[model samples]
Target chain A: MTAENVTAADPDTTVRAPVPSERRGPSSSAPRMLWGLVVLVAVSALALTTDGFVSVANARAILSSVSFTGILAVGTVVIMLSGNLFSLSIGTSAAVSSMLFLYLLPDVGFVLAVLLTLVAGYATFALQGAIVGRLDGNAIIVTIGAGALQVGAVTWLLPGSVQVPDGVDIGFLTRSVLGLPFPLYVFLAVALLVQCWLHYSATGRQVELVGENKAAARAAGLPTGKLVTVAFAVAGLCTAITGILLAGFNQNANLAVSGTFTFDAIAAAIVGGSSVIGGRGSAARAVLGAVIIATIANMLLLRGFGTGVRVLVEGIVVVLVVVAAQRRKRSIA
Target chain B: MTTRPGMARLARRSRRGGLPYVLLVVMLLVFVVLPVVAGQQVTSFNYYNLFQVFASLGLLSVALGLTMIAGEFDLSVLGTYAFAGLVAVKLGADDPVVGLLAALVLAALIGALQGALVAWFRLPSAAVSLGVYIALLGLTATISDSKTVPYNNLNVSDVLDRQYLEIFSLRSIIAILAVAAIAVTMTYTRFGRDVRAIGSDRRASLRIGVRVDSILVVLFVLSALLSALGGSMLALSLAAATPDPGFDPLIFALTAVLLGGVSLRGGTGTVLGIAAGILTLSLLRELLTVLATPTYVSSLATGGLLLVVAFAAAPGLNAWWLSMRRPTKRVAEPPSLSRVG
Candidate 1:
């Protein structure tokens, strides 16, 4: 899970080598710095102007809301670094794992069900990674197919919502600490570890190398297939974690709201300065993206917009951010 | 990498005559022969039901196939379907023809807007169109008030409802005509050649003086317009519209495009092939439903087909595997090695 950054300093592993521009683009602090300031200004303005924006309860709500998307974004960033673009299947992965977690909870109890779900998540995503990387399949179609398969399976097999067992103590996963839910800590911990690995580890650098140029990476003797597989596996693990925690947060396993999570995660990653072209950004930035989306979504709610409006607003924001990111990339090139 | 599959298919097609017939035979086995044998569904198959289902998705797959021919993904076609359907159903309460024209024009304009972003502004078609899609979905829901409109009040268009021999509807005929128009355009027109040429190699097309960006815009607009037609036909057939039709139709459309052997990487295949794909899926769904299986199972099958179609279409796995077998095959890097060494 952790990469060895020290080993990444081999003469051939130099970051300053003739890597793709996206690999070097992150080294310049301009786009990231601009994003941070924009987020800061937006937050300050909202806090100053809105009535309930600064409340601890709203802050807590925002934190809880962002945990799933934030964690998902971290995984998406890794896949992007590998240059596969995205997995449209992340939402389905969450829904499948969460539904499976609930389904198995009554039968296998808690720990075992959670464990089984984690494995399922890994296998599901790993299959996609294998097909896309090993067989050189298109990422978009593979992911879209995988997503449809997962959702259809759940719909056909599970059919409806399942409740948590009465005696299973699911309270621990969502219990509050310092005005924030436990899930927030989980998100932060995952982001911290991923940030460290991506910025300071050998495998992390290899992931970048593969993403920056699959051909170049292969020419340089890197194991491109295995690295890509690992990236998807990481995404699956994160999605599975989110799934289990969501069951705890909602006190039930549900499939009614399976639409927005995957797109939101991709939006967060793009907003956080991660290039869809791969080999850029960090988990820390993805965390920033999640927070930004959360704040905007929360703000829309506070302003009396319906759920539909909120979704529309999120799409507008993503479009704007992607356009800006594209402009920046073009300028840098 | 994205273009590899389509390019490979074109390459293979050039080297072999009658390959398309072989593919058509394979498609028949999957779409017709297998379903008939597995469930005896052929006798139970209703022509009206089949063509009704075919009317919407068939157009959608053809529309999507055209864009893929032009070397881009149009995830927004589904979005256009919903949006244009929303407009037509809402406005048709007064006049159906006006509603149809409005939907078509708006759909085309919306498509052109997205195409401008991809062509003029140089945005990634997938991501940008995805944003457009999500937004359109949300807008459709919002404008429709998040409820299924009964649509009982609207006067049905006489043209859309006109029946031929009590089996073939005018709407289905229109859909077939649209497909024919697109096929003729792709096969016989300079625009068609340029679109395929652009998909095969954009830079080369540009170097040969094709108006690459404008042609891309036209292809996108055509896709959008057809998607709207599909939606309008759906509204007419169902006599209702839902805020969300979900994505089952989109998946089926994509599956049809792939199954009919249209390449996702673009610049290959035919309207006839895409129609065959649509027929396969539409009939498959009808068979599954008639067999007392849940409708969701069709979606599951759709997912499976997506993977299979994408895999089959690539046409490059053997060559790629051969290359993989040869390690240390370091093709030399061009100069500017070591950053301008």
Candidate 2:
């Protein structure tokens, strides 16, 4: 029997049948548009009612605050799209990358430091990808182990905090571009590039196919392992961008700086309506998710709600999205 | 008739599941015996400390192992641990038992909710539990006001920590008894068999009338209770609770579960293996402490061990190794001949 027929014959495999393309047509886009409209109205209402919410400074604050998380979320989208699930090591990888950037800034100059830091991030995640793809290790557990190893090794080798030496120039990274922070621009650029790549590229489609049904993809002779590894490599590059920008913006780096990056990135991706099970998300959607979270957090800060409430709401939103998506999938099937 | 075959399968599976125990023995020899042989004074106090750590983290490991064996991942255990610790400390200041009861009750509710969502919707437990995890952390922060809560009765800690028989304490004894009870239940009960059957194939179990949803709910509730009990005990012993207990407990629990020979794919593992894994880790920690090595070394060792174990456990590793060993096998045998054979 053909692989497709075999997969269809298996009841267990049939449960997770690849969502039809027709379902992603008008049916999906309509609800997505409505959600966008609702968000716009809500943001407008918040601006009209709340004091200081409409100002450019507040806007800059919100964008810049979410820039690093947004970048990391975009990376998370790639991993999810390729069916690797979330990388729990984003925070540690970012922290390690930031430390590397700072440590290299004085010796190698800004451009070289950034390039080398990106390479390190890519290499680190590529190794994890190799294990997950080539060796069939559990993605979540592999990332967790990698996170611990990074934290332990960094703590043993580097000082508690790293700072660029005197006379080193990294102001270009922190400088504004068209009235927005440099990191914000990077977030936008990365989102646009990745979104286009996922939509238009052959490899990206193969990634989505692999994520939809890995066994089927393997049967079809697709390079599932290589595609998964490429997804992870792209994610690593995005994380490295966040790390470099964070170091440049803060003018120093520390182990604790990326404390909530992993969770926050995950929250962004899921809230963006991305399936945690994989193959149905984009960088643009992740950016929107990040923006929504940041705006809500900003509003909460203005209204005197603590960080706890903001985080509580974020968690609620993720759970709602996940449940809603599952219900929708069930109905569609 | 059905259970007979299942039991025999389990028996055969467990006979091969002796790696964790062997690892435990090796760790004991390296960490406990070697230290004493090197003229390091091994006192009852050391054993006391070792069991104290074991009782707390060991419970968490067992909780995680149970859920994993039932084909679900409960990431909220860490959040539950921290929240329960804070709840026990803040509310149980006057009466420790009340605090523990309240914590367990709350944990049960949380577990039930998460279990229902996952079971009813057929959602991924990892994602669902992660949401609960975040919410629990937020709840913990709100209750503790993002600060450490101190118990009014410091004597409670002293009582819990009071050593007996050179090693066992009140807390350790409770933990050990709980583990023993669970081990027995898992080995000699219909519930245990159903859990394994479900993990092996959820749809098949459902078709076979396994009551998959309810069993999953009970497993989650049990896991949450164990974690809460562990957290409450730790809080009482420490005489304080923090909003964040950090990721160390989760990491340690996961490492222990994996090292215990529990497959991430689920449906295969023993509670005794989990206990041995926990003991091995505890001894390693004690060894590091005795050596006065830097704290990060333990983290490095634990992380490295997790990676090594994960890599070793990968399904493709065996296939890759076989292919590597006989690189010319495919060339030597043509496709048609191989298929005919």
Q: Which candidate's lDDT is highest?
A: 2
**TM value for model 1:** 0.88
* CA error at residue B170 for candidate 1, angstroms: 1.3
lDDT of 2 by residue, B77-172 (tens): 888888899889888978998999999999999988888888888788888888888888878777878888888798889889888898899999
Candidate 2 stretches greater than 4 Å from native: A1-15, A18-48, A329-333, B1-15, B328-341
What candidate 1 gets wrong by more than 4 Å, as runs, is A1-19, A22-48, A328-333, B1-11, B14-45, B154-162, B320-341
lDDT of 1: 0.77
Q: Is the docking of candidate 1 incorrect, acceptable, medium or high quality?
A: acceptable
Per-residue CA lDDT of model 1 for A1-333, tens digit only, reads 012222332333453245455535655568757866886797669756876888878988898999999999998988888888888778878877888998899888888999999999999998888887776777878898888888788888884887887788889889988767899999999999888887788888888778877766764667777888888888888889989998888878766545688878988887787877676678988998899888887887887776677667676666776676665433220
Most DockQ-accurate candidate: 2
lDDT of 1 by residue, B232-267 (tens): 778855777766776666777877887776666677
TM-score per candidate: 0.88, 0.92
Residue A51 shift from truth in candidate 1, angstroms: 3.4
Model 2, native contacts kept? 0.50
lDDT (Cα, tens digit) per residue for candidate 2, span A1-333: 233434443553345554645336577767765765775687668856877888889999998898998999999989998887899889889989999899988888878988999999999999898889877888988888888889899999988899877998788888988888888888999999999889899988888887777766764667777888888999999989999988888889998888767878988998887878876888988998898888877898988888777777777777877877675554331
Worst 10 residues of 1 chain A by lDDT: A1-10
